[model samples]
Target: MISLVSLLVAAALVCLQSGYQAYAQIEGKNDLRDNLQPNIIPMPKKRALRPFINIAGPPPESARLIPGTLLELSCEVIGFPAPTAQWLKNGEPLTEFDDVNEIMNIHPTSLARLTSKMIVSSAANGDVYTCVATSGVKQQMASTTVVTVAGNDEESLFGLEALFRKPSKPIITEYYNEVFQEIGTSILLPCKHFSTSPSQVYWFDGDEKPVFGNPRMRILPTGDLLIPSLHWDDMGNYSCTVKNAYGKDTVETFLYPNKKQFFLVTVN
Candidate 1:
């Protein structure tokens, strides 16, 4: 050894150089992520998810009605998953075999549907009518006419014509000519049927087009028209057309400003 101090100094210098080499080895980047690209996350699509369970429907615009009359209940609904349907009357559930109840059909895709006529008879004359449908997560509801008993027998009853008659027709057993208001007051036209065929009846306004009653205008089971309120336009020559396999018949009436007879009123 040249000298003990000289030997120690040489060892110290070697250690320092080794440490420097290790530091210099990481010259380009100290982190591995420096050369890597950032990752991007994809977003979800903006479409309505399938199997949506939601009720879709509206209650009937009217409820009060006469016994033996037919009331219609309808609704439209969309479901992610299809749902089963159930009908109810007076809170009691209904099935296919339920008497006096029928289902027309569900839509082609089965998203919407209609209920058959809820015939209001003496049994249901004063009972409430309702329809309810249930799906996996959705429920829909609709209502039927109110059962009102007419003050008169002629205006309180409704009957269907025989469906098997070769020539079908609707027959009126009673006729009442009453003038309740001025030119605008609507009149009730009661229609009855006694035949062997399905009696298809049509009501025409003054000009022969189908005449549908407004909320203020009501058609009773006995085929009587009820005007909740009258208007000048309600005055006209109203007509009732009945058709069946046997034959067809038409009835006409002239309503004026007052109870004035058809020929008695002076036309302007």
Candidate 2:
């Protein structure tokens, strides 16, 4: 029979060789990667591996933007089991179906690339926004440097400057002069305004009467009009008028009910 000591020595040598092989394989892959350019996305590891995030794009740095304009904050997450992304404004989770927000997301593939986009209508100064990504139980966060409002004051600058000074005439930009929608579907007639003071937005019905007593219609804080769940009688010309202390503006859009599908036919 073989000696007991000799058998133990042989087993030790086998274990050492196996360990070295694993170490060499890992090191080799690292060396190869170091020699190549950065990848658009990280390689997907096995499902059993620990989850991690590689932020594709960092949040926007401190910047100046005009009021009544849209602000988009986005982030991309990559990991196993597929990570999910969401946004927080001033630490509050943003709502998707709210009046001022429309969210867009691109789901992850193999290695998992999840992208989150938030549209902030009429961004103001001193706004704090953050992006967060989560995979299972773990989470990663990205934040911005403060977005100060444009103007010259500590409390009343950037966002609410109109509250401190005399009001100026507002400028209005209409998205669509006319729109046709299928009955029972909601629509937003964008009426963007830039003004020295906060302006009042008034909407008139097809009969030229103020739009009130109808629970479905309302004006957004940004001066845009929202009419949820349209009906057949809702068809007619709608007027969007903005007024401040100094001046006023009007943008008219026609809403017609579409009972059938309309398509353009090309004849060659």
Top lDDT prediction, candidate number: 2
Q: List pairs with backbone clashes in candidate 2.
A: 125-149, 149-158, 150-158
Compared with the true structure, the alpha-carbon lDDT of candidate 1 equals: 0.43
> How close is each model in CA RMSD to the real structure?
32.1, 21.7
Could you tell me the TM-score of candidate 2? 0.39
lDDT of all predictions, in order shown? 0.43, 0.57
Clashes of 1: 30
Poorest stretch of ten by lDDT in candidate 1: 259-268
Clashes of each: 30, 3
TM-score of each: 0.33, 0.39
Over the stretch 1-268, how does candidate 1's per-residue lDDT look in tens digits? 1222243357557655655555454433444557464432222223322333333444464565544443444433333223333446667865532432322221112221212233333334545556554544466666665555546554443332222222434453222221223344343444443334566666676566665754555555545455544465666767666677767766555543333211111111
